[model samples]
Target chain A: MSTKITNKEQVEAFLESYDTFLFDCDGVLWSGTHLLPHVVETIELLRSRGKRLIFVTNNSTKSRKAYTGKFAKFGITVSENEIFGSAYSSAVYLSKVLNFPKDKKVLVVGEKGIEEELESVGINYIGGTDPAYNVEATDASLASLARDESIGAVLCGLDLHLNYYKISKALLQIQDPNCHFLATNIDSTFPSAGRLLPGAGTIVGTLITSSGRTPVALGKPSDEMMNCVKEAYHLDPSKTCMVGDRLNTDMKFGEKGGLGTFMVLTGVDKEETILGTNPLVTPKFYADRLGLLYELLQNN
Target chain B: MSTKITNKEQVEAFLESYDTFLFDCDGVLWSGTHLLPHVVETIELLRSRGKRLIFVTNNSTKSRKAYTGKFAKFGITVSENEIFGSAYSSAVYLSKVLNFPKDKKVLVVGEKGIEEELESVGINYIGGTDPAYNVEATDASLASLARDESIGAVLCGLDLHLNYYKISKALLQIQDPNCHFLATNIDSTFPSAGRLLPGAGTIVGTLITSSGRTPVALGKPSDEMMNCVKEAYHLDPSKTCMVGDRLNTDMKFGEKGGLGTFMVLTGVDKEETILGTNPLVTPKFYADRLGLLYELLQNN
Candidate 1:
């Protein structure tokens, strides 16, 4: 059974229980280009209440800097330091957690966000958004294909310009026994402009199937993402609450991290999903929407 | 235990047992650009014995016509009717078995081979090497992306020109409840110029993960390919022998189709793979290489 946080008392109690709040942006705060009602007010209220806010998103398509710009578009103020997207998390995991070698470069099979994050972490990378790799591959190209010996890792994410040349290069790079394979996230699909589009998982899944190797995925629901957050913030798990709309990524991530979870039915999951048998992951608290928290807090 | 046919008597006995022979081209007949010695002699011998020869390949990159041209280059003449490549098989499966509606067309995410095969069957298709769909997709393009309502199926195969636009279009088309999702083969990698390259399965696997739907795969190790061959040549499974280099695709295909399987140690699988305990699928007979049959026949 999940507690429904509806009234002002419940909202105040919930707020008092957690000093740190981790939010999944896509579903809870907004959906696609439309911002959910009262999100700006609720977020501001939480900020005023001294909540340490962290926007943790599985969208690896955008860097922290880009996310800050997107937040501004939503009429919300957020610093780059407050954002932890899968691209940033993956870079953190590689540079900080894995202690990726300085001499070697990562062969990226993703978009510019990944490259930007890797650059922020001072990690040398090749192939992401490279015009040479974006072209159509032929027999001659495939035959003469060569890789830089410095490529020690293959990092992949949601790549819009995913081409055979890139996949082939990544596949070849990962063939070396010493090469590490990493993925930003394995999100199968994300809501986009009123429809579900293929996500990073599709790209990673293709590589996994082609290369017959699974990558170390750094994103929501994975302990690595949680670990990245924990190491960066140095926060106590018990004092943190993960608020999101999805069960598999957000709620499961919270549960795995041993943090309190709050499910907002503004995203992929529904109320029945929370109450249903064999639920993927049960949240500690459930709400009709994130705006409900705003109404509760305002009334108080 | 797999019986290893070594001598003239053993080879003669093996040939006499099966009326039809299905050969996997790459490793058995040739590897890369070089034709394996004695393959032409062996194939000629089989034809002289009144045996039906069917070249069954999981390589969807080429149509039957293209395969025939390749065979000609190897000094071995094979008609398009004798070739059952994944591209041809998938086309046959959709047009002949599925009896796809004439009013509707297939949205292809593959190479020119698939387009040729579909055209040969008089099936209307969009995409597949079309310059419009091969371009990189942008936010503007994705927003303006439209689907042809007449697209009732999404067919995929090995596509070097795979891009976001094609994947997105296929993803959207398959969203229709009535649209059929079809794949030429799910072979993860295929031998190419002495190295393994990502195959059609990689492309199809991406769509499968993204769409959250599995396609009806029509290639080696699946009965659909066998059905295609049977329909084309009137093959009786019991009297047919599948000879190939790979255990998983070729041998497994033969075993699943209830045909006698002959393992040729010239391609992906090694001798230990067939002799090892807990083998995936045991072939009915084994040989050092397909050329050994030529030697045995010549000696006889």
Candidate 2:
């Protein structure tokens, strides 16, 4: 059974249980631009107590550096190293882990974030933010549709400019079993302006079905992203606590990584979801919101 | 065992077995623009013998009327009623089988074919071929994204102008469990311009993943389409033969509908795929090509 933290002692004990905190950004720190109450103060309290913080977000629309700006906008002083957006993690996984070929380029089905992260890692890429691919496909236009032999991998992420032309070209390339099929994250939907929009998984889903192939998703709940973080920081999973709102991604990620899990009821999932029968991933501790930890400690 | 038709006796015996022949278009009639050699002659031979012909295609890009124009282009006289494209079948299924509410509209993630078929049946629709939905999605633009309550069903088919905006809106609408999620057909890839391009299944796949809902597919291999054809044509399954290229859609469709299955080796699957152990579906007869029916009769 998951314990619901209410008293000041419980909050203090929860804080003391882990030295490092991995937070899922969207629903935890802020929900569609409006920062949750006591978010900044709570992070500040965690930092003041000499705890390490890493922002883990499945939203591949923004790179690590771009997310730093988003953090600054909320009055949070988060460095580039602290932010692990799927885009950055994917780039790292491709270059560092997979040892992507030097002569080959990665075909992107995403926005500037994936492109930016790929460039930052000194990896050549195409498709994302490419004006040539922005046009609507016609039978005549697709007449010359062929695989680009230079493309070694097809990396799919959330793309606002997603079109048939990009995916059609992607399908041709990935059909070669030798070519790697990668997804930044498979999050079905992401909250946008208080509304949920189709996420990267939706974009990847098209290719998955058409190609009769599955892609290697390097995001939450996948040990790839966890390893990317663990290797970068050399942190002990047993001493790390994953604090997030979603059970499938955040809580499951923590549970799979052997990290302590703290569920906050301020995002996609709620309290009953954790306590209900057949819960997706039950957290060790649950609270009304992330701010409750700060509130309990400050009050008593 | 599948009988490989060769001589006059096998050809004549095959012809005498079935009065009505269901032919899968794309691979059977023509492969992309250039019609396969002796296709017209083969159809002429079937017509000469007083055999009924029904052109059934999973390619939802064209309506029955549009397909007639294509048939005319190839010197084949095929009326709209004799054509059963997935788009038209889906439209018929929605109106007749489901008895779709007259007050509601279908949100389409396809091309003019679906819109034309829906309009033919006097079913109101939005999204398909709509210039408004053709634009690329943006965070600012998707902020107001909400479900159109009037949309009772989301019918997905092959859409060349597929964009994130169309699917994002589709996900929001289908999120409502009351809304019917439908796919015209789930053919993975269609041979286009000597290349395989992502088909209708790819477009529907995005919503399937994001919405976490399975759509009611109305196409080949589906009993729904078979029932629609059976009710309309009043054909005897025992006297009908499904002649097509693909095993999964064509052979399985015929087998399930209690029709004789005849495999032609001009489309997606080759001879080895069918004769191979653990074949997806087995056909009652196999031929090198559809034109062999005419060739064997003419030469012998």
Candidate 3:
């Protein structure tokens, strides 16, 4: 797993391998409220190198128009096709793998992102329940789909008010061995109120905790959506190096599925990760942000 | 489960009837730092009411003397005898029960608090391997007793470094069923870096996740230490109201166990709770702090 970087020079020498790059949005480009300094330049530098680029974020809370608006405000110029989020990934995956029945009805257990994805794929969705709070069954209550095992798969995503009851229902449905447990992402927590708030990951963890089985992850680190990326682009994996700050999505996407992983210290990994935890899974090359990639290429 | 309140008084009225009050400390008092202002006064008022009070915290990190000193500074007075930390609870249960197979020794999964408790109970202990971050089985790594079937039990407490290897060892010693799987407490997480640090509750949750069995909780909500309080004070439960902030421990202790639960807002329960949640399993009477209790009683 060690992508041998004999030195900084060797890593710089091998920059021309990938024709396309996939970047993660959250930890790579910006955290919740701030963008990395070199984010805009990073994309331009890659484009100048004759490389295709896409910003893939698993967060479904924001739509493409919203993301585009946000990125434009950050002075990053990109086309609508350049941004691929989990909502698109889920929609694309479902479109290919198992065509929902003509009258497909899904009990939505997530937020707006999930609802839109299912709708695009020709599945009818039960309006998601309000965010649960103040109940023991909040976990169970969140997975409204679990009440009816007839639902083929429970599409998992972020739920703010996760509790035991929703977890109980999801676990119960999964125990039937007939139901599929598809989680949007397994990020343990997300930043909220300037404090880490329990995200889809914690709820997914609880479901797995109760069911004793890992979910079929729809977002990052799972190959479930990579096929969509390939099909959408009509491109080969060998020509792409995933570049992002988040390990679970971008880095894992690159490393696990046979692409180069470039970790920028800018976003998700944080200052704490400068000293790597899993060295084998470490980035092939890192820069302060995308702007430095241009300077390195020029020096080479 | 409603204690007959003839007047317009609330849950505190029932709690005031108890002669000997048991409290769960961690979530009930302070989440670790920043003492709730009324905590000292609440306990003082209870004492003034001739209530025999005990401070029972499930956290096994600190010793009895340590807590007694800390509380003294906050203006609440208590001796080492009045505190029952999970560390102390674990020791009491072991000494009275299996006794760790005499000379065979036992591995300790906790910190100095655990060591002190064991020594006080005449039980010998040693540190375990890798000293996992799992919060439970913190003592499972005890190299002195890990492979030894002669070791009667793997005594677990609040070790933050608990992990998978420890769980494997417990299963490895499955032939010796009497070799107990004792846990000090089942707190899901502790407050750390202002985020949820996985607690012994997560560790035990993992065990029940892996093995599908519940380990006997030896802390405040458990019958073991409550019996310890009963034995020590010769107290009557019907007259006892357990005042605490955390719902699962302090509140549940009084409510489910046939004691009136007084939930003070000063601890773990939220101000949003007054809006509605299970206030029965919550506190019968709610107060901003212990002072409110004093004011209510003093004015009456």
Candidate 4:
């Protein structure tokens, strides 16, 4: 049943037959805005071959609209649907499985992107709404929810307003075995515009550390997210291709979906990582960038 | 030569000579607010025996004032000089070693404790005034600093607001060989009120990870902190007993100082850890809590 082959030739053959393509934004396309020279042309070339392109990023700090804007800045015209971020996928999954609670008492403590996702998903996002953004207010609001009986489930995502107290409140509520604890993703950290920022994963980690319990991760490399890609795109596993930079997130997504994975060494993951550390999601195709990948395709 | 006595009695005989006690605050005395029953009495008992006590925490979050206040709230009275948290030590070390520039600019991303320490050390903290308080502000301020040449060192500690972007910026500053990098402590993570919070070690992890450069750690288990404790108290290591929860931090502190390390499984480290993990500092005496320790002391 596992059609996923590690052989380069077999994967290339599969890519030739696939109708849909998935690309990881960071490493595969460009390493955070320094565009590889021929990437746009390569996508255009793939489009000419009747391949559907989907750009996915595990970084949930940015919403799809933000991605669209960033892509616009990067000179790539990507539709909101064509781009799938972990935030988007997380939101979509929570909406479907979590039977939108009526109490709508959610203690949201993530970035603007996560807040946007929650509101879009029909879940009542409730917590400290300080324009000044006070952690004290966030703490009290969350603690109030924890003490409340109406609050059903606790939804967690990447919160830019980070702290120990914020997570303390969320764990206070969700620690009850009756409640469902769903996380945006399991990425412990992310590279942002700042120095280094804790991701939704860190928040999720907070909950796990406090309660000694794991939350249901709704985003990338999780079986659920992979299925989302499969069902929506109607992916023929043998023919589909996944191109990404990170071996764990992007490449693993391909592995789960039984597609050929291409690792581009442009972003977070180094060249050595593909060969050295993670053996689970090793890429079938290794390229410097997506454009370079297309160049190899063309030269051959 | 290593001590030849194997039985627990020899440990008691050895500890009888020590005149000063170096105690790690969190894991040994208590895990957060809940105190080990005999902790106060044991300290009182030790004090009655004419032993000097210094309570230390590797956690860089709060200052001596905060710890003093926290202990006061728990109905314990201890002097400021008798306390040694990583934040205080780092500040003291930085003030002595690092040459200040004309602007007095340092980018800070930790909590109140680390802030107090930095101020005490005469470090003019810049970047977002709120240490990892707001994401947008934290990100914007840090991103600006990453590109700024005026900024000297990115001073970091245990900021519960830890994330990827901030670490990225710290790395950016550290990437230049000209920049000085300092970590408050090297504890990978810490147990907070609810969950596992990223420790000062994780902050250091970002620098070592991105720039492939190790930092100068000024906190616990680092000979600097140990030496600071010894000189401040005028104590003989052979006669003193070091008590704490963690084998790595507290026990190691005792071990490195050549003091008798007694581990109490009441805080961050458990008895399971003693049995499983190879502690760098092996406690001459090990027990469940201060009460058990008291019983052992009487019998031995």
TM-score of each: 0.98, 0.98, 0.50, 0.70
Compute the lDDT of residue B223 as modeled in candidate 4.
83
What value does the lDDT take at residue B243 in candidate 4?
77
Residue pairs with clashing backbones, model 1: none
lDDT winner: 2
Task: Compose the digit string of candidate 4's lDDT tens values, residues A1-300.
Answer: 123333446435645766878887765566544766788888887787788998877767678887788887877788988987776776776677566666656666566676676677776665533343344433244334334556666767766554445555566667677767777677755555423444566556556655656777767778777776676567788877787767778788788778877776666776666666546666776765566545556553
Cα error, residue B63 of model 4, in Å, equals 4.2
Model 4 CA lDDT for position B222: 86
- CA shift of B247, model 2, Å: 0.9
Query: Residues A132-226, candidate 1, lDDT per residue (tens digit)?
Result: 78766988788877656899899999999998888988888887768999999999887889888888998998889988898999998899999
In Å, candidate 3's interface RMSD is 14.7
DockQ scores of all models, one per candidate: 0.85, 0.83, 0.03, 0.13
**Off by more than 4 A, model 1:** none
lDDT of 2 by residue, B72-132 (tens): 9988998989999889899999999889999999999998889999999989898998899
Off by over 4 Å in 3: A1-15, A127-146, A161-172, A191-195, A246-249, A268-280, A295-300, B1-300
What is the interface root-mean-square deviation of candidate 1?
0.8
Error of 3 at B265 (Å): 41
B1-300 per-residue lDDT for model 1 (tens digits)? 899989999998898899989998888999989998898888888888898888988878789999899999999999988888888888899888889989989998888888999999999998898788877679987877766789989999989988887888888877776789999999898777767788889999988998888899889888888888888888888899999888888998999888999998888899899888999999999998998998976773
Best by DockQ: 1
